[model samples]
Target: MSAPETTTTTALMPMVIGEHRIAVEALSVLEILGPQQWVAIPNTPPMLPGALAWRGRAVGVLDLGPALDLPTLSAPSTRNRNAILQLTDDTVALSVDRVLEVCRAAADAIAPVHAASWVVDGGLPCRGEIELDELVVPILDLDAWAVASRRAR
Candidate 1:
């Protein structure tokens, strides 16, 4: 008999942003914070609207709605949560509607995102798309997003 095959799986944390369901790599997420009172910075883009104090330091809050061409969160709700992401050289909080439990999927389950898919005017960076329970979810590319946001500044 041949040797048993081993399957590799990827861990992802699904989140709700606006009306869309997306996910991020489980390893990149540092923590999730509840509704925070962020200070909007003047002359800043809508995507990077403001910053919030976290652990004695200020962390920029990323509003993916504008970037993803979706409706921005208006009224504050108790369900709102901010996911703190550890990017290359910076730590920022992602404003999300809700944070879901982490899940893992086989490598082959993830598919490439089409060009015509939902993206920003420039481009909404995505690592890939995975279908979880018949729902296709795009995995945001945080590193790429961070770089693009900086360049846009």
Candidate 2:
């Protein structure tokens, strides 16, 4: 077979989590939510920061910061957005700093990660750029995270 092409016509919808940036397939995002009141839950992991009341249901929130065991880039007073995943079976919201404009990139542009991160062990893809915003960001694997969360419980 001949060599494959280098570019693809697709783009990605990425969000800034704390200071790190990541992309979830545009189709995977249910909606982008603004800041809201967070209620703490007892005996939960640090990543499970709290829960939010939404549409008559309580949605658990996950903070990518502790989820990856990475310190907040700048004490997150400005990073205050949440990306709700299109969960086919559970309820959880990913607390990010903000959502940026969708950008175009090839599948090969997603660099691999080699270092350590709690999230990586949990379900973060071993691939994706880490040094986004000068900080190591573990691009999350939503499907894997869901699976791990269930296993953790």
Candidate 3:
């Protein structure tokens, strides 16, 4: 016989990117850093705004706007914000407009995502969703987004 085991729940960390609010897996977020030095790289795709030095390494940053086909922030600055997103063995830095406060909710609190049912501002496909106080926020599918971005280039 085996004793019943209960699963522990952790809150979701949603970040505000441009006009969209997306939450990646909380643990996947390495750190949220204030704007750092960004240097433009010639011949890079629009999705890659620039690269920055972090922890003695050059981490190329991606701008979700163009990559996701979403509306970009009207006025982005060097002082914007960055969310270091890590998945599997891959990691990358994201330049977000701002990050919202951490929200407490079970993963079930979010609605299931569908390939056809989920759609963002630019008709982008989403994987999951959460109903925030004012609006429904979608969870960005980083893996899928990465695949699409590579195809776009």
Off by over 4 Å in 2: 1-10, 68-79, 115-123, 130-138
- The 10-residue segment of model 3 with minimum total lDDT is 70-79
Could you tell me the C-alpha RMSD of candidate 3 in Å? 3.8
Model 3 CA deviation exceeding 4 Å by range: 1-10, 67-79, 113-125, 151-153
Ranking of all candidate structures by their lDDT, best first: 1, 3, 2
lDDT of 3 by residue, 21-140 (tens): 777667678888997667777777666666777788877676777645665422234437888887554567877778777777665666776432434544445667877776777776
Error of 3 at 69 (Å): 6.4
Model 3 residue 48 lDDT?
A: 69
**Deviation from native of the Cα of residue 31 in model 1, angstroms:** 0.8
lDDT of 3: 0.68
1 versus 2: better lDDT goes to: 1
Cα-based lDDT at residue 93, candidate 1: 86
lDDT of 1 by residue, 125-150 (tens): 88888887678888888899889878
